[model samples]
Target: MPSANQAQAKVQKLRDQMAQMQASTVEQIAQLKAEAQRKYEELQLQFKTEVAAREVEVTRKYDELQLQLQNIMKMFQQSQNRSS
Candidate 1:
């Protein structure tokens, strides 16, 4: 039969092992959460940057169309003056 002191020592060792494993698991969970948050923030920034770039592109296209219309109007006015 195992001695009382030896059995008590074995139980204590098992308890220490369990505590260490729990601490390690908790730390890993915290690290994973932090990583996920960082990725989310980076994606948000990228989305905002893309949206800003698209707004600039649209504005430029609209300006080009406005200039084209102005040129067409001036050409018609000159033609009318020559006919007078």
Candidate 2:
């Protein structure tokens, strides 16, 4: 049978191993959280950039349509004046 001292030593070793494993698990969890946060920020920035680009394209198209409408109105007025 093992002596009391040997049993106590084995118990202490097991405790130390458990503590080390817990620390390692905590560190890994922290690393994963940091990675997730970085990815989220990156996606947010990309989304904003895409939205801004789309807004610019839409505004450009709107301005072009306005200019065409103006031209059409002027041409129609001239045609009416010539017919009068």
Candidate 3:
């Protein structure tokens, strides 16, 4: 049988090992979280850029349609004046 002092020493060593393992696990989790956050920010910026490009495209199309409509209206007015 082990002496009481030896038993206490063994228990203390196990406790120290457990603490170190816990600390290492915590550090790994923190690193992973930081990496995930960085990825999320990058994705968000990319999405924003895509959305802005789409918005600009839609606006350009709308402006082109508006100009076409105005031209048609002017032509109709001129035709009506000629008939009168």
Query: Each model's TM-score, in the order given?
Result: 0.78, 0.88, 0.87
Residue-level error in angstroms, candidate 1, position 77: 5.1
lDDT of 1 by residue, 1-84 (tens): 999999999999999999999999999999999999999999999999999999999999999999999999999999999999
CA displacement after TM-score superposition, residue 8 of candidate 3 (Å): 1.5
lDDT, candidates in the order shown: 0.99, 1.00, 1.00
Instruction: Summarize candidate 2's per-residue lDDT along 1-84 as a digit string, tens digits.
Output: 999999999999999999999999999999999999999999999999999999999999999999999999999999999999
Ranking by TM-score: 2, 3, 1
Q: Residue-wise lDDT of candidate 3 within 1-84, one digit each (tens)?
A: 999999999999999999999999999999999999999999999999999999999999999999999999999999999999
Of models 1 and 2, which has the larger TM-score? 2
* Clashes found in each candidate (C-alpha, N, C closer than 3 A): 0, 0, 0
CA deviation > 4 Å runs, candidate 1: 76-84
Q: For model 1, name the residue pairs that clash.
A: none
Q: lDDT for model 2, on a 0 to 1 scale?
A: 1.00
The regions of model 2 sitting more than 4 angstroms off are: none
Between candidates 1 and 2, the lDDT winner: 2
Clashes of 1: 0
lDDT of 1: 0.99
